[model samples]
Target: MTAATSISPIPVAPVGLTARARRFVEVDSVRVPRRGLGQHRRKWIEHGAPAVEIDRAAVFQDRWGGLALPPAPFYEGGPRILGAGCPEGSTDEGWSFRAGSCRVSMAYGFRIGSDGAFGIDAYRWTPLHASTDGWVESLALAAHAGRWAKTVTRIKGKAVESLDLVGFEPVPEVQGVTDTWWRGKDSLIALYRGEAVGLDAPRCLEAHVYGGLDEWGLHGG
Candidate 1:
């Protein structure tokens, strides 16, 4: 004989996503605190110099983990959410224009395949030709380094559909490139530099490669 029992169904919020995919992306140059346990330092020893000197300065790996939120439109006429795309409670949290001194921004998002493949998504970029103190100074710095000043251009809304357009060439033979990315208008760029370096780039890259396979539509096409 079997005993009769009553069961209740727990109400669950409908998952807002169609297919929860994970993406890792790197954004370069979000200022970090100059002093702390993880403050940056570098060392160099001249060939003829006596002792090696540690340059307790300049950029170092300050990467931290965060979440990749769905690409939502940032419209002046639409509702905007604070801390969009970041993990529920992470130090990497804030709204756009929340002062560069506070928190960093999401740089890029890339999908990682289950069999270990990956590609670029949206890019984060700012205009190069701005008439402001910050813009002029940034341009000057890049020129000083004999390089071009670059900012991740925003795509407004919607993630880029084509990976190839964002410099993710078909690497049928390689698992993944020692690559990084920065978001730009409707696309991302795969590279090691140009505001796509160190922590900003690697954290996002790792997310795609190791963090979010299922969410990124990895198993299938």
Candidate 2:
């Protein structure tokens, strides 16, 4: 098994996303407490993430394997999930290896293909993005956009399909299939389709609209 799921296509962030992707995506930052165990530091460095992302004294490999909830859409996200995708063995698929357990199910994570991008680890080597930074950027956007939006309208079950995304532009930072984000003039629409697709439960489909936002809330630090 690798990071690709047979149900979905290979998630590619693509070279041309929205204008927001032109510059660095700003997300809500948080403090992560890492126990410095430098055992897997070398792999992290080799993975091509920024040196500042993980410390030399921090434990790199996941001593504790992440628990994947079969197939579900309720993947609670945070920077911690990245920690779950710890380094794993290597493969012939572009030297793909386990990077970290995403903590959002999909069997946690596997830094698939040559890009070393994080995603489900299975027969398919689909990646969440072209690089690790893209994942972080997408996660940050999800965390911050909801908080800033004054109104968060939720849609679930059959209602989720009714959401019209006519004017919204796809947010490519996440490069998600079941989970996706869209940007509108004054709002952000997020959809959680993991459960609906993974479990084959149409009612599990859910969506949210984050409306009423200013520049600061959307992208400002």
Misplaced by over 4 Å in model 1 are 1-154, 163-179, 182-221
In candidate 2 the C-alpha lDDT for residue 79 amounts to: 27
Best by TM-score: 2
Q: Per-residue CA lDDT of candidate 1, range 8-96, in tens?
A: 12212122211111011112212222232122121123222112111111111111112111221121111111111111111332111
Q: After superposition on all CA atoms, how large is the RMSD of candidate 2? A: 11.6
Superposed model 2: Cα runs more than 4 Å off: 1-74, 78-96, 101-115, 121-130, 175-178, 198-201, 218-221
Per-candidate alpha-carbon RMSD to the true structure = 21.4, 11.6
Go through the candidates in order and give the clash count of each. Answer: 19, 18
State the lDDT at 202 in candidate 1. Answer: 33
Estimate, for each residue in 1-221, the C-alpha lDDT of model 2 and write its tens digit: 34432222222222443433323221222222323336556777787643444431132233212211122223444223234333333545534444444544453344544444544444444454555445544555655676588988888999888888998888766676546778888888878765565455688688878889887665543
Could you estimate the TM-score for every candidate? 0.17, 0.52
- Residue 65 of model 2: what lDDT? 23
